[model samples]
Target: MMTLALQRLQNTFGYDSFRPPQDQVIEALLAGRDALVLMPTGGGKSLCYQLPALVRDGVGVVVSPLIALMEDQVRALSLLGIRAAFLNSTLDTESAWQVEGALRKGELDLLYIAPERLLQPRTLELLHHCRIALFAIDEAHCVSQWGHDFRPEYLKLSALHEQFPAVPRIALTATADARTRQEIIHRLGLEQAEVFVRGFDRPNIRYRITQKQNARSQLKRFLETEHPNDAGIVYCLSRRKVEETAQWLSDQGWTALPYHAGLSAEVRQAHQHRFLTEEGVVVVATIAFGMGIDKPNVRFVAHLDLPKSVEAYYQETGRAGRDGEPADAWMVYGLQDVIFLRQMLEGSDAGPEQKRIERQRLEAMLGLCEITTCRRQSLLAYFGESEHPPCGNCDTCLDPVETWDGTEAARKALSAVYRTGQRFGVSYVIDVLLGKTTEKVTANGHDRLSTFGIGTDLDLKAWRSLFRQLVARGLLEVDTEGYGALRLSAACRPLLKGEVCLELRQDKRQSGGRRRQVSTDQRLTLPQRELWEALRGLRRELAEQQDVPPYVIFHDATLLEMVQRQPGSLGQLAQVSGVGKSKLERYGDAFLEVLQAHRGDAADL
Candidate 1:
């Protein structure tokens, strides 16, 4: 059975071997055992259950959260010549009925359905009568109420286990902490399932967090340096911001689109479709845009505002570089973000216990943003893994941020806050410290205080950085009632006196030197570049003819391999990593023809 599974993996999925823990998870499910698979995004989590379903005796039923995700997976599978279908709201009644008929006739290998539809009595009755391979739940973290993507409907998924007691079940998620993991197990009734925890580290992604200073220009600078013509995601905290950023990027000559819940469903769907189907498109969106995004080539994920928690941040940024390529996770945050998030948290309807947990998560996220050590190490530590060395990719490791002793500076800043009655925001306090004789300052007569004009040495940017870091370090708190007034926290008393010294990273707002541009066609010669474009042209033509996404026809990685290897025959083409037996038999000759021309031209040259 295991050997057959491996053969199917190569013949159908077009891979020589399985990724780590995939083999184990597949073996368990093939042996009629359940599994709770915790793998990061782009970790090939789908194949853990997908390969087993093919090897098993019946159709695989996948419970997906998003209609777009289900459609994309089904399209990709169908391109591999698999008999896959999805029953979702996107389909008309007649089309859905046809899919149901296929399922009843055992003509489909896999069927993707939303949880709500699958939980219906009618769908359950139909499934009960069919030969059942297994139930695979994608994004299983949604089952946890504590998780950021919680769906109440997922709470009812326990019925799958109860009703299909004889069938194996596999639950998978990209991000889940210990608490959410336990919650998933309890809610999904997967206690007997073997748990597979893959490492949470996405080393290919470079993490960079900057203090917010003109976030729009900063994003542009980063984009120009890092991903000039590549696809990426820029996350914003609000719908208005999403629209504004998207328009701004568009004006800057990017193919940018806005996505948020505030947009009509039709617009959201259309925008998402474009993002998937087109190249060099950037989607500026809120958190609503990226739960099940399967786009593998996102080069960077930039955050204009802080996410609600570290898990949210991790998951959002994980959307980038799903292809295991070098990518970036960049963010810009300030004290205002802190105040905004705190206000949102306090205004929520969650109970005391839930609020407490959320507060801890927020604090952990803040710590990650402000950490002087390796960002990767701190991020992994939050998910309970610790021993990584300093990654030389993040801002701190790359530039080696310099820290200055800011004990007296902090005391002076705090004193200004106090002397100004602690009812002013950061700008007002900074103004007082810088001895700015504004109308409000003169009216308040705050320049008469001892701390006034005391912070002449530090620049405005430095003061902003100090205040932001203080909030991050929990030495300062935001007064919600006072409209984001900066107040000294109890923790600041140590620094207020001479009892403690504070070290802060010196504010350096410069962009790094231009990075080396990595192009997909870099390895190709001038002649090969022509062949690469020709090959891509053929792919786009075939995809358009078949009405599928170009990637569904062949991923950029696969096309690059074909170009590099210049395989001349079906046998040689089969050796390409992504060229499965079915695809080889169907499209091999056409691709081989292109390769042969390129090979001949190269020889002539």
Candidate 2:
């Protein structure tokens, strides 16, 4: 059975071997067992269940949460000649009926259905008539109430075991911490199942977090310099901001779209479709935009606002570079962002215990931005994977942050907050520090405070950075009920008494040089560039004809391999990764022609 599985892996999926625990997970399912898989976003989670479905007795029943995820997977499977179908609300009545009929006849090798549809009695009756190879639950993290994404529908998925007691099942997700993992196990009754916890580190993505100073122009420069023609996602905190940013990018001559819950479902679906099918398109959206996005070539994910937790940030940024190419997780945040998030969290309707947990998560996110260490290390540690070495790809690792002895500066900043009656926000406090006789400051008599004019040594940006860092360090807490007023925390007493010292990252002003940019990789020569363009043009042509995303034909990785290896024959083309028998036979000839022409051109040169 294992030999046949390996043969199918090579012949059907066009891979020489299995990536470590993928083989383990597949083996468990093939042996009539269950599994709980925690793999990274681009870590080939699909194949673990997909190949077993083919090797086992009957069709695979995959429960996918998103219609887009289901459609993307089914279309990619169809390219490989797999009999795949999906039943979702997006389907017309006739289409849904046809899919149901197909499932009844045992015609689908894999059937992707939403959780609600699968839970319906009519759907269960249909499933009872067919032989099911296994049940694969994608995005299983939704089952956890503690997770950032909590779906009540997922809480009812435990019925799959009760309904089909004998069939094997596999639950999969890309991001889950210790708490969420236990929640999934207990909820899904997968305690006896083999649990595979793969590393959560996406080494290909470079993490960069800087303060927000003119976020729009900063994003533009990053785009023009780092990702001139790449597809990406820019996340904002609000629906109105999403619209404004998307329209602004469009006005600046980019293909940008707005996506949020505020838009009509049709508009949201249409924008998502265009973003998937087209190249060099950027979608500015709220957190509603990135779950289960399978686009492998997103070059960057920029955050105009801070996410609520590390998991949200990790999962959102994980949407980029799914093909394992070099990508960026860039963000710009300020003290106002901190205040805004605190106010939002405090105003939520969650119970006290839940609110406490969320507050810890929020503080952890702030700590990640403020820490002057390896970001990947801290991020993985948050997910309870602390054994990784320094990734050397984040902002601090590449261009190390410089720290200054700011004990006096910290004391002065703290004193200014205290002497001003602790009733004012950051701007008013800064005015008192700089001794600016703003009408409000003078009216309040704060201009006569002893801390006045003490901060003239530093500029406005430095003062803001210091205060943000103070809030991050818990030395100062934002008054959630009031209008973003600062209050010194109990943790600040020792520092205020001069019993402890403080060091802070020096917030340097941006010059013409700005942040150090990792020079973009230049792999293609003059001849290779022409061939690359021709190959991409051919891919776009074929994808448009089929009305599917270009990646379904071949990922950017496979095409780069084609350009580098210069495959001459169909047999040689088949050796490139991602070229299975069906794809080799379907697309091999055309890609081979392009490669052959490129070789001819290079020979002439």
Candidate 3:
């Protein structure tokens, strides 16, 4: 059975083997054992249950949350010559009935359905009659109340195990903390299930968090300088922001589209389809768009606003660099973002205990943002894992930041805040420091403060950094509601009176020369460039042909690596970092042919 599954994986999935934990999970499922699979976003979590579904004696039932995901998965499975169908709200009565007919006739090998649909009395009756080999739950973290994208309907899915106690169940998610993991096991009644936890280290994605200042321009610079003509997602916090950013990016000559909950269903689907099918298109969206999006060549994931928690941040950033090539997880945040997020939590009707737990989660996220250590290490540690010596790929690891004694500056800033009655925003405080005599400053009579203009030695940007660091360090608190006035925290008292010294890491700008620019002259030349384009064309064609993401064939970095190495044979091609045995066997000859043609031209020269 295992050998047949492996053969099917090679011949059908176009890969010779399973990713790290996939085989183990598949074996457990095939043995009629329940399992919990925790893998990173780019990891092959789908194959664990997918292969088992194909190999099992009866039809496999997959419960997914999103409609788009259901469609994409069913389409992908069907393209592989597997009989698969989905029953979702998008299907009309007749279409859904047709799927039911298929299910009854045992014509479908895999069936995808939404959680709500699966829990319906009629659907449950139908499922009880059918011979279900295994029940698979994707995005299983949504079952946890502590998770950001919690769905109350998922709580009903436990009935599946209740009804068919003998059928094996497998749950999978890309981002789940320890709390969520425990919750999934308890809620799904899978306490005895075999659990597989993969490493959370996304070494290929360069993690970075910049203080939000002129975010649009920063994003523009990042796209123009680092990832010109590359595909990416620019995540915003609001529908308006998504539209505005998409329009701005389009005006700047990028193939950009807006996607959010507010758009019509047709428009949203169109935009998402365009983003997936078209290359070099940027999708400006809220958190609604990322789950189950299998686009593999996304070069970057940029956050224009801070996410609600580290889990959401990790999952969203995980969307990039899925093909194990070099990608970036760039985020711009500020003091206001913290306040905005807290305000959202406060505005929720959830219980006080739930609110308290959420606050702690947000605080933990803030700690991640503020930590001076390696960003990747800090992130992994949050998920109850650790990386030694830190990943040398993130911004913090690539450029070691410097710290200076900000004791005096903190004292001055605190004194100014105290003198101004601790009721002003950052801009007002800055005006007081610069002695600008702005209307608001004068109207509030902050100009008359004794500590006014004491920070003239530092520029406006420096003062802003000091303020942001103070907030990040918990020396100051921004009121969640209202205009976000800065208030002194308990930690500020000691620093204000000089009883304790405070140190702040010099901002990324002050550290200088860390951001690398791709030089035009060092770029690929002549036939190499031509070959690179041809390889990319082939990748797109193969991606469409296979109905998988393009990067799954080969990443741009791998292509460039191939162009540079010009590997002459399959063995030489397998030496490339991303090229495993399966990929080498499948694509090695085509690439070698391209390289050989180029080599002939080089010899002629």
Candidate 4:
């Protein structure tokens, strides 16, 4: 069985070996055992179920959440010469019947469908008669009630166990914490299944969080330097912001587009399609955009505003560098983000416990940005992996943060907040401290207070940065139930009295945009460069002919290998990493022709 699995992997999927827990998970599923798998994004989770279904006697029934995801998987599978199809709302009735007919005839190797469709009585009846392979549940974290991506329909997935007791079931996700993990096992009735807690760490992605100083300007600099020619996603917290950012980026000469739930279904689908199939397209979107998107080659994921939770940040950033290249998870946030999120949480309809959990999650996210040590370690610890070593790739690790004795400034800020009755907002309180003497300050008699003008040593930006750090340290609190007011916390007493010392991060940044140390685009010699473009052109032309994404034809990694190896025959070409028998037999001659022509040109030169 293991030999057959490896053979199918090589001859069909064109991979050499399994990536850690994938082989074990597949082995269990092939033996008719239930399994719960937690692998990071791009961790070969799909292959865990995909290979078993092909090797086993029946078609693998995959429960997917989104139509675009299903279509993408099916198309990529078809290119690999696997018989795959999807049953979704996007298909016409005739097309759906054809898929159902194929399923009954045991002609498909895999079938993808949404949970809503899978749970339907009609769909259940159809599956009952088919030669059922194991069931693969993707994005299984949606079952958690407190999760940001909660879907009520997912709660009913437990029925899969009762209905198909003999069918091996595997649940998989990349972003489940301890609570959500337990919920997945219990709610999915996978008590007896083997649970694989493959650690959540994507080291290739560099984490960088900066204070939001002119978010657009910072983002522009980050993009212009780090990922000038790469595809990426810019996430915003609001729909209006998504539109504005997308337009702003396009105006700056990037192929930018907007996507959110507010857009019509057609527009969203079209925008997502362009993003997936085109090169160097930046999609600015709210949280509604990136759940099941499978496009690799995204060089970065930038957040113009703070994410509501750490899990969302991880999952969203996981979209970049899926192909194991160096990518960035960059974000910018500020004090207002904290207040805005707190008030938004207070306005929610959730119960107290839920709200508390969410509040802690938000605080954890803020705390992550302010940490002076490696961020990857902190992120792993949050997901229950506590012993992770420091990742030297993050901003903190690359450039150590400088801290200073902020006790005096913190004392003055806290004293001012307390003296002002803790009723005013952050800006107004800062005004009182900076001795603005505005009408509101004088009317409130704050100008006459002893703490007034006590914080004049620091400028406005400096004070704002100090106050934000104080809030993050729990010395201050934002009023969630009331208006966005600054309040003194019990933790501030010692610092306010000068009995204890406080150290805060020093604000340091470039006054304007900056350049990269070196471009990441690998340098190719003259011959190699010409050959590289030729191969890509061929791949793009073939992809257009077939109406699929260019990567589906051949990933850039594969083409780069072609450029170096300069294979002269089909037999030699088969040695490339991603070259399988299906692709070799299908597109081998065309690629071989291009390669031969490039070789001739190089020889003539």
Worst lDDT window (10 residues) for model 1?
A: 511-520
Best of the two (2, 3) by lDDT: 2
RMSD of each candidate relative to the true structure: 1.7, 1.9, 4.0, 1.7
lDDT of 1 by residue, 1-605 (tens): 89999999999978999889999999999999999999989999989988888999999999999886787788889878888999988899999999999999999889999999999999999999899999999999888777788889999999998899999999999888899989999999989999999999998888988888888989998888768888999999899999999999999999999999899888998899888877789999998899988888888899999998889999999999888778889999988898899878877899999989998899999998888888999988888888888877777787677889988888888888888998999999999889899999989988788878899998888898888888888888887574888888899988887898999878776665345435566767888789889898988788777766677777778888887778877999899988898888878999888888878887897
lDDT of 3 by residue, 350-429 (tens): 89988888877888788777777799888998898874567877777777777889888888888888788888788888
- C-alpha lDDT (0 to 100) for residue 120 of candidate 3: 89
Model 2 lDDT per residue over 1-605, tens place: 88998988888788889987999999999999999999889998989999999999889999988776678778889989999999988899999999988888888899999999989998899899999999999899999887877778899888989999899999999988888889899999898899998889898899999888988988888887777788999999999999999999999989999999899888988899898999999999998888888888898999999999998999999998898878889998988999898888878898999889888999999999988889999999999888988888898887788999989999999999999988989999898889899899888888788998899998889999999999888899888785999988899999989899998988644432234334223667777778778888899999999888998888888888888888899889889888899999888989988888888877887
What candidate 1 gets wrong by more than 4 Å, as runs, is none
Question: How many residue pairs clash in model 3?
Answer: 0
User: TM-score, each model?
Assistant: 0.96, 0.96, 0.88, 0.97
- For model 1 the local lDDT of residue 551 reads 75
Candidate 1 matches the true fold with a TM-score of: 0.96
lDDT of each: 0.88, 0.88, 0.83, 0.88
Q: Compared with the true structure, what per-residue lDDT tens digits does model 4 show for residues 308-415?
A: 888889989999888777788989989888778878887899999999999888889888988888899999999988998888888888778899988888888888
* Candidate 1 structure lDDT: 0.88
